[model samples]
Structures are given as structure tokens and as C-alpha cells.
Target: MSQDRAAGGRMGDSSLLRRLNHAAALSAFLEADSLTLRELRAVVGVSRPTAEDLLSELLAEGRVEETAPPRQPSEARSAGRPARYFRFRAESGYVSGLDIGAHKAMAVVTDLRGRTLATHRVELDPDLPAPERLQAAVSAARSTWTQAHLRAADITGIACGVTGALRAAEGVHDVREGPFGSSLAPYSLPGFTEIDVAAELSTRLGQPVAVANDVKLAALAEHWKGAAQDHRDIVYMFAGHRAGAGVLIDGQVHQGRHGAAGEIGVFPMLGWETAVARLHARGAVLAAEQGIEPGREGELVITSAARQDPESLAALIAFTEALARGAAVLALAVDPEVIVLGGGMSRGGAIIAEPFRRELAKLTLVPLEVITSAMGADSVALGAARMALDTVITDLLTVPGS
Candidate 1:
């Protein structure tokens, strides 16, 4: 038994070494564009014999492609000869990213560098049971992945941003009605519980998976590539059918103690309950004053109010003032360098942005730079894809199997 176990250990190490060699060779070939065995060794940090052994394995895997860049002989300053370089055939692999929302889901496929090669979006029933909804979402992703002419094996990692809070300990999230509702039991949603989205998709395609809160993912997207580009500390306020926030401090997301830190929609008196109600009230008043039909529940009648109906305007102003108060509290707590207003309704642009700034100014002595989200309605989804890509890149570069 001991001899057999020892043999198994040796086999495992051999397989791992092969994988590591492939990864290192692939990393150098793709990143450096071309690399010799020595450079591959440096990247892999392995002995020459080990590297050679692994290179043979990679060749068998068809992961490394030999390149014959015209080599020029050195003038022999030290009597040295030129060496051949190799490149990884990364074109052989691909990756996918998915962004799941309450009512919609978006997916994107990209090559190793994160350049988007294809994208897709589909509407979904949020009311569906968690598992079913997740299945629907996964189906959508798979459809899009197929459209992109890529399979699951092409996927290296998946980063997903969910609408609910990702519980700190559970690799899952807790879905609540709002900050005030009964804490729902743990959910088995795709990005939340089963984490099965990745595993299931991996079974279909073969890859690792990662997940994050959609809002936090959006904040990361903005921090890395969008509007909040200038400031390290920022409060990203995303207001839509639902309102929430994402906090970035020193270029990192602060997920709060309960994984609810940026759960601004639940921020005490200013939580989702109060803020959403205020907005709904504004919508109701606008409906009454302008004789316009009431917008659906939780949706503000922005068009009616913006039309300059006196009563509706007053109600809208009041709602804006309440939002300003929420922003003020955020200012006091995080002291974010910039407060970014984003989400669906935020597309009303100055309607919410300018007034929000003025109202915030009235409450606090410290003036804050307030701006609309540059990413707009697609911000969350785009951020989710970016988050997925970030995970794939990180894992490919850092972790062994990923």
C-alpha cells in the first residue's frame, strides 16, 4: 500500500509539473510574444530537466507552437550564440463572462487578453425559483458562448455579479426584499449557492469559476476602466428600479463587515426601503398631478415630473432631497473622493445628478464632486464581464490549475 501510495504521489507531481510547465510556457509565449526555453524556465521557476520534461508534455497537449523568428547571431561580445524562441498557441483557448441581473442577463466571450469577441443578452423572470432562474441564465450564457463559436473548455474562469449580497462566509448570497425585509434563507442561485454556474458550465466546457456582487463588480469596472477612473476612494451610487451602492477605497472594494458594507440601499434610515419608498411617492404624486398613469410599483414617474407639473416637481424635489440626505450620510461615513450616480434612472442625467449634488451640499460642509455614471444602464453587466475576465487573468497568471 505504501509503495502504491508513493507511486501515486509521484504521478500527481509529474502531472502538476506538466500543467505548470504548460502554464508557464503559455504565459511567456502569449505575454512576451515569444520566449526561449530559458525564459520559459524563468517564468516557471523550474530546473532545466523539469522544464524539458514539461515542454514535452505541452507539445503533446498542442499548447505550445514553435516559432522560427529570424535569429541573428550576436557579434560575440562574450562569444555567445543566438537562441530560438517559442510562443504559446493561446488562440486555441477562449473565455466567457456573464452578468446576471434581476430582469436580464448578459454574457460575453473573449480571448486570453480580455478583448471581447462576442456578446449576448436575454430577459429572465426574476420570480422564478433560484435554481430554475439560474438554469435559465446558464442556458443563455451557453447560447451566447455557442454564438461566439466557443465551447466551455475554452473557458478558463467565470466571474459573475449577482443582484443580492454575497454572504461573507458562504460562497453564496442572501436575497432580501430590501434592507428592512426578513432575511431570506441562503439561496442556491447560480453565482450564489451552487456556484454551480461555473461548475455546470465547466462540466460542459471545462474551466474554473468566480463570482462577485453585481454592484461591487460595477464599481470595480468603473475603478479600473470607467468614470471613477480618477479617484481611488469613491462611492458609486447606482439607482434604478432598485438602488444600491459600491464603495471603493484605495482602489479596492470595501465589502463591509456583513458583506453589506456598500449595501447603501439598506443604509440605516436611508436604506433601500426608505429611499425606494421616497422615489415611489414621487412617482405617485407625479401621476396624480399630471393625470399621467402611475408607473409600475417601485418606479418613479420621471417623465411626468420632468414635464414641469408643479405638484409632481415638488414631489420629485422631495425625493431628490431624501436621496441627497442618503448621499450625505455616505459622505460622512466613507468620505469618498467622488460620488458617482449611475443605473437606469440615473440616465435622466442632470435631473438626478445636479439636484443630488445641491441637496448633498446643503447637508454637508465638505463639498463632494458628484457625477453621473459613465457606464450607464449596461454598467453592471459590463462590469460583471470585466470581473469575470479579471478572475480568469488572475488565476491564469497566479494559480496553478486555473
Candidate 2:
């Protein structure tokens, strides 16, 4: 009996080692883009035979593919035949990211490497019912995947960004009704407090869906491919139709125990609650003068401010001051390397930057570098895609047969 138990233990140990080697080899292929057999062996710290076996397994699973090596320069060519190379099959699977907001539902489809393949946007009424709003977001995602000429079965993961705080319980997130929830009240039906956004989206999409606050996702997008890529610690501020913030500490999003780590705008004393009201009031007048819909007021205000329209510039400054107050509180608490301004208003970042910095400086002990988002309106959706890609990769690395 003791011998039998020892044999079982040995088998378990060997299985664990094999799994580890498989994961390591796949990780190397992901990071290096492509690798030769010799390079894979060195990177994964495995024997030649083990490396070949790993490659064969991944190739059979469609997770890897052979690629032609780059042509060698005439002088650099040393051998009669070139070594073969293998690469992660980024095209093997795809994932989607979605941003569901008061005014628009946007979706982005990306490959395993997080390359955007297609995108779709659907305009929405702020007063639309919650169920219809969610349906619209799903439709946008489906449209984007179709635009990429891919089937729903090809999507390995999906993620969504919404307006309110998400409380996680047993791997599921429930949208908590709070200040942000009140802001979303116009779009929500009765019993909004009991809604499970992640579960809803997952069921609709026929796959597991990850969900988080939209502002937090925007911060992730900025860090992944936008302004704060060079900085590990960042504070991301959303300064368009509404005010919100996202914090990254040590290169990870700092979601508090309840996932409200950067919800400074919730505090009434911070004045973020009324910040966009200033822009809206000014934008209303500007829109009327230009004979446009009130929805375009925000853009008109920014454009007018750019031309140095005194009234419009004043409104922009007032909005900036109110926004900076909330940002200063976050900055004092987190001391991030940079504060990234994003959202719809960031399109006029140049006009908003100076006044925002001036106000922030007055409230903080040290000056902080402030930059605008490079991702613009697509940041939240892009970040959502990153979240979905992470899920897919995690599953790929852990499952025994995957």
C-alpha cells in the first residue's frame, strides 16, 4: 500500500511539471512573437525533446503555428538550411471589449495579442430602459465581431465597462446603487440595484463576461496603450459628460474592498457632482446658437473654448477647477507619477490642461505631470478588450488540456 501511494505521488509530480513546462513554453511564444526550437528550449529551460513535444501539443491545439523566418542578409547567412520557427497563433481566437455608457454603446473586437480587428458603436438614449440598453451593447459587440468576419464561436472571452461600482461575490459582480448609480438612474429600470451586469452580459453573449467601472477600464486602456504606458502609478480622470477617476498603484488597478477605490466624485464636498453641469449649461447655449442638438453641446463648448470665446472659455475653466479639486484629493492620497485626463473632453486637452494644472497645483503639495489620453473615446472599450484577452490567456495557461 505504501508503495502504491508513493507511485501515485510521483505521477502527480510529473504531471505538474509537464503542465508547468507547457505554460512556460506558451508564455515564451507569446512574449517573443516567434521562436526557434533552440531558442524555445533555452527560454523555457527544457530539454530539446520536451520543447519539441510542447510545440507539437500547442500546434495540434491550434494555439501555435509555423512561420517563415525572416530572410537573412547575405553576409549573415551561415548555414545551408535555416532553422524553423513557431509563433503564437494570435488569429486562432478573438475576444471583445465593450463600453456601455449613457450616450453610446461601443464594442471592440481584438485578437489574442489584443490587436483590434473591428469596432462598432451604437448611439443610445440616456433614458433608455436598462434591459434595452444592455441589449444595445450586446448588439454592438455582435456587429463588431461580424464586421471582422468572425463567428461568435471564435470569441474566447468578453468584458464590459459600465458606469457604477461593481461588488464581487463568488466570482460574480453586482452593480451597486450609489452616486454613480443615481447618475445612471435615467437609463435604469426599477430594481436596478439588483442587476448583475456581468451575468447578464455573459448570458446574452453565451460566454463568461467580466465587468468593471468604465472609468477604471479607461485607466487600464491608458496604461496598456496610451498616455500612462511609461508610468506604473497613474491617476486617470474622466472629464467629459461626467466626472470620475481611476487609480493604478504598482501597475495594478487599486479596487478597494468594495471596488470603489477611486470614486472621489461620490463625495459631495468635492464638487465633481456639479462640474459637468457648467459645461452642459454653456454647451446648451452654444448648441442653440449653432442650431444643433443639445447632445453636441459638449463638443461645441470645447470648440468654442479653443477659439478663445470668452464665455465658453470661462465655462471650461470653471469645469476644470471643479474637476481638479477631485483630482487633487486623489493625487494627494495616491501620489501617482502622472494624472491622465481622458473622456470626450480630452479632445480639447490643450484648452483644458492649463487651467486644470493651475487648479491642481494650488491644492496639492507637489506639482504633478498632467497629460491627455491618446486613446480618446475608444479607451474604455479597448481596456475591456484587454480584460477579456487576459481571461483567455489565463484559461489557456492553466487548463491541463487547453
Candidate 3:
């Protein structure tokens, strides 16, 4: 190689290092918007000159702004001038998060700072073809897009949470994998075996799109802003229409080989779904025998009935036992720091938490905290939003040009 070319390649290494440092500084600010020069240097772990150069590059890119006051009081006291404080400009772009299920689809719009701007939901005809349901989901997302006052092209990217396993190889939702139970099929048409979720959304909205398993996204949501926030190892179970689980190992969702890591419900020995079915059956029988109105949701009916009739109460305890059995099995294998109950059944916190925790305590030597989901039905969508936001931010930092 020529001397000039070899020397230029060496210069490129330093240039690349500076670009990486710039991205790191921007990321630090994104985590918590305001920071002083010293604080930025400490967080980014760079020399004073390197930190200043990185910050200057971010400011020039219009990603960082000098603010009047530091968010942390100590930073303000340490740095006399308010101009020393810098904050990330969060409003520069946005992302779309979508949750698609058998019955309905929901969408949430979030800014670069990961704040929800608007949300939209649309019901699907359970008997309708899959393509129609997909269209409905797209329409629902567009409704939120309209609410946010942005065209489809304005979005940086999209993340979608769907009802079945993520076929990463195909970039589609593998609808054949039934997490919601075999009795309940996913929203799909006869002709389409797999829903090309990423391609469809990206085509419809004019941006890159990504897809993930719904339960895993829900677990991610919990880790980000729910009961599992304090714990890195978590087993998050979704016990709504059917029983499903998502595992988090070391602050990351653990989707094992074939994306079937948490298919614990498939083993009938665990008895989580069986217990749920039994509870619903017993509730229906009791309602008919007593001539009382039965609640539509099995979870609500079971939990509410537990407060009344002795049989229903016993069934609730049994349900907890089964749930604990499944959880204990997972805990023994992975030793999660916490186990979270999410989805529809989790809304019945009082009836589920105490018994489940008590039974879990009996089964496992290593005690684990059990709690209900705080996000309710919105967990998957919110988690999808987090993923969407990450892609946008990743591109912002990693791409060659803004």
C-alpha cells in the first residue's frame, strides 16, 4: 500500500473513535437529559478533551442542547454557569409500537425520549381473514399517527408485538405457534401461513420495522417500568386467554433456540392453564346452579367468585397452586430474582398474589417476590414502543450521517 493511503487509514481509526465517543455521550444524555461536563465525562468515561469534542459534535448534529439549569442540583452547584449543562433534544423524531392479538390490535406512539405521545386501538372480527385483521391493525396504527400529527414517513421506525413466536429468519409472526392455547387461534387468513409483520408495517408506514413475541415484549415492559424493574432475572407469565411466559436473564429477554424458551405451559404437568380452565368451568356451573349472572372474563369471574362461595375460593387457591408449580419449575431452572404475573389474569391481583406467593414459598428454597402487572393490557404495546425507540436511537448514533 502507498504511504499516504496507510497513513489515512490510521487517521480514520481516530475519526471512528471520535464518532463512537460522540454516540456514547448522546446515549448518556438520553438516559437522563441534563448533565454537566464533569458528569458527562464521568458517565461516558472519557478524557476532558475527548468529552468536550464528543459533546461539540453532538451539539453540531442538533442532538444535544445547552440548557439553562442542570437537572441534578449537585451538578449546578459544582458548575457555576448554567450554560455548562447539556440536555438531549428528545423531540427530533418518533417511533411506533404495535400490539396485535386475536381480538384486537393496539398502537402507541412515542418520542425519541420514550414518552408516549398517543395511542389507538381497533377491534378485529375474530372470524375475519388474517389479511383483514392485519389491515385493521395498520389502520389503528395510522389513527395514532394521525393523533400525533405526523405522516407515516415522519416515523423513524416501528416495533411490533404479535400473538405468536417471532420467526426472526423470515421477519414474520409464526402464527402456528399457539401461546394463547390451541383452542384460540391467532388473527390470520387461510392463505397466509406466517404474517410478514416487519415487511408489512414497514411498507405501510414507510420505515424500517421489527417484530417480537408479545409475551417477551411484555416482560421487557415490566423490566423497563414495572414490577421487575429492580430485578435482572425475571420470569414473567401471561395468563390471559392462555398461559405463556417470558424470561429475562441479565436484563435481557431470553429467547432461546427456536424462540420457544418459555413454553412451560405446553407441559400439562405444570397445570397453570388446566387450573385456569377448571376455575372457569366451575364458575360457569356455579353460576347456572345458583341462577346468578356469570362474568364474561374467566379471571374476573374466578377472582370475584373466590370472595363469595367456598368452592370458588378453593378453586382460586388451586389456581394459585398450579401457577406456583409452573413458576417454581422455571425458578428452579433459571433462579429468577422475581416472578411477575401479567396479562388479563394479573388484574385480579388480590386473589392471585397472596396464594401464588405462599405456594411458591413452599416449593422453592430460594424465596422469590411475586407481583401483578402494573401495565395491564398495555404492557406489550409499551414494550414494543421501547424497542422502536431503541432502533431510532441506534440509527441516530450508529449511522454515518444524521
TM-score top scorer? 2
For residues 1-402, what per-residue lDDT tens digits would candidate 3 score against the true structure?
432235346666655656666777887998885988889888877777778888888888888888867345664456454447888987677888898776678999888887888998887655657677667778888999899898876677788887664534434355464544551222233333555666776777666678788888999999988887888999997767556788999988887666667767667677766677777777678667667654434554665665676777877778778877888888889998889988877777677678878888889988788878887677888999987887677776783632
Query: Lowest-scoring 10 consecutive residues by lDDT in candidate 2?
Result: 183-192
Model 1, position 164: C-alpha lDDT score: 69
Off by over 4 Å in 2: 1-12, 165-172, 178-194, 307-310, 399-402
CA error at residue 305 for candidate 1, angstroms: 2.5
Local accuracy of candidate 1 as per-residue lDDT tens digits, 50-112: 677767766677667678754566663344575766666656556666676656777766666
Model 2 Cα shift for residue 284 (angstroms):
2.3
Ranking by TM-score: 2, 3, 1
- CA lDDT, every prediction? 0.64, 0.83, 0.75
Please give, for residues 1-402, the per-residue lDDT of candidate 2 as tens digits.
332234345666666667777888888999986899999988887777878899999999898999988777899977677889898999999999999887889999999998999999998877777888889999999999899999999999898888774534335475456554454211233334567777788999998898877888899999999989999999998887877889999877788776767877767787665667777888999888878865777789889988989988988888888889989999999899999999888778668888998999999999899998898688999989987888889887884632
Per-model TM-score on C-alpha atoms: 0.69, 0.90, 0.81
- Model 2, position 69, has a per-residue lDDT of 83
